[model samples]
Target: MLEKKSEFTIYPITVLQDNIVWVWVHNCNAVVVDPSISEPVEKWLLEKNLSLKAILQTHHHDDHIGGTQKLIKRWPQAKVVASKKELKRIPFQTFSVGDNDVFHLMDSEIKVIEVNGHTNNHIAFYISKEATKYNILFPGDTLFSGGCGRLLEGTPTQMFESLCKLNSLPKSTKIYPAHEYTENNLKWALTLEPTNLSIIERLKLIQNKLQKGMTSLPSTLSEERKTNLFLRAENIDKFTMLRRHKDSWKC
Candidate 1:
């Protein structure tokens, strides 16, 4: 039997109310995703002796980019990657990428996926064929474990299409979203899909994880297929209805 080699290690640092700062480390160099604050991320990297190689911004939201400037100041050579279309919003971006553009970092290939529902220029990073894994999606706020991001700037149609694109990925793909909204999302989902055993079971498991103070994120595409109402949506109309219902739903 061949030993499995770890391609990357992801660190989830909870910041603010629900924002999660994801740090992807490979060979002592790190790439941060949607860092809401700088101090903790800076301290974490320093303690691990890992160099900050780049910052991947999915949107221009303040919580996502507030730490970029400070992190760049600590590691001036670190690349700040963001959507080229949002130059005015994310002006500090050193590497302005567009839809479908492929870039290399930390011995892995990253493909930029434009998902404009949460924000007009929101983008997701997809890493396929990393070490032995088939896929990994850093979907910012576009897609969550059991729910999706609010339609802040884009329309339901845009969000629907963006989610369709994500659902097309391999089932084994691991998702690393920007926030820790799984427990709440799943709770709301269960109310909507009362008869869905998959949703019920998943919610119970996630609730247990939360009680134990463990993260219930980085959910697999397969898991979402069974329990995520957004991913299971069959048509745009269905997606729009679900989005509306969730938007009005409290708790």
Candidate 2:
């Protein structure tokens, strides 16, 4: 099995101004995460000769699931995996999952983590194989490179707890968030702690990546620990304050 041999890489497709559609591939099969649109993704997959195996929906938001039905039309065999709790919104879900449910995809173990702050029943997929060097987290709109999603449907406490769960993953875990917001997020963090070298250095690096038209994401948990203010918050009160501040922050 590919799980035993361990071969996979996640490719990012930038779309819809800021949304990033991650495609995890192994042995000519691909699994898409929150495709904001279909044409670009379809062209990329076809060019690579990859077969669509599944689509993982993290939330019911239009930007997240808008391209799903079209992709399904292109590949009727592709499975649409989503939260069972959001059946009404994500009615096309073929594999309805819940928090902590483990499933196999492309020979890797994929665990569903309910991260409800971005939206009620929003989930993240944590993928790992025994021989894999690093675990990969598709955190949809929950945990970003240097920040977290807004409290759209849940409270600060729930968002805090959700982040804690993600933070508990291996330090080597590679975080693949759904947007290219690292530069702005880090810039915002720097405003709070201008003397913090970690934030300053990272912001510079992220800025360079942006200038080069490169993605500064798939950030490791280790990096986030040093640079992401939301990940560094020690308590719920602090998390709440940070959330409120970030919401009103300009950059």
lDDT against the true structure, each candidate: 0.91, 0.92
TM-score of each prediction: 0.96, 0.97
> In model 2, how many backbone clashes occur?
0
Q: Candidate 1 lDDT, tens digit per residue, 213-244?
A: 88888899999999999989999999999999
Cα misplacement distance, residue 18 of candidate 2 (Å): 0.7
TM-score of candidate 2 versus the correct structure, residues matched by position: 0.97
Candidate 2 residue-wise lDDT, 119-195, digit = tens: 99999999887785659999999999999999889989999999999999999999999999998999899889999
**Which candidate has the highest TM-score of all?**
2
**Candidate achieving the largest lDDT:** 2
Regions of model 1 farther than 4 Å from truth: 1-6
Q: What is the lDDT of residue 130 in candidate 1?
A: 50
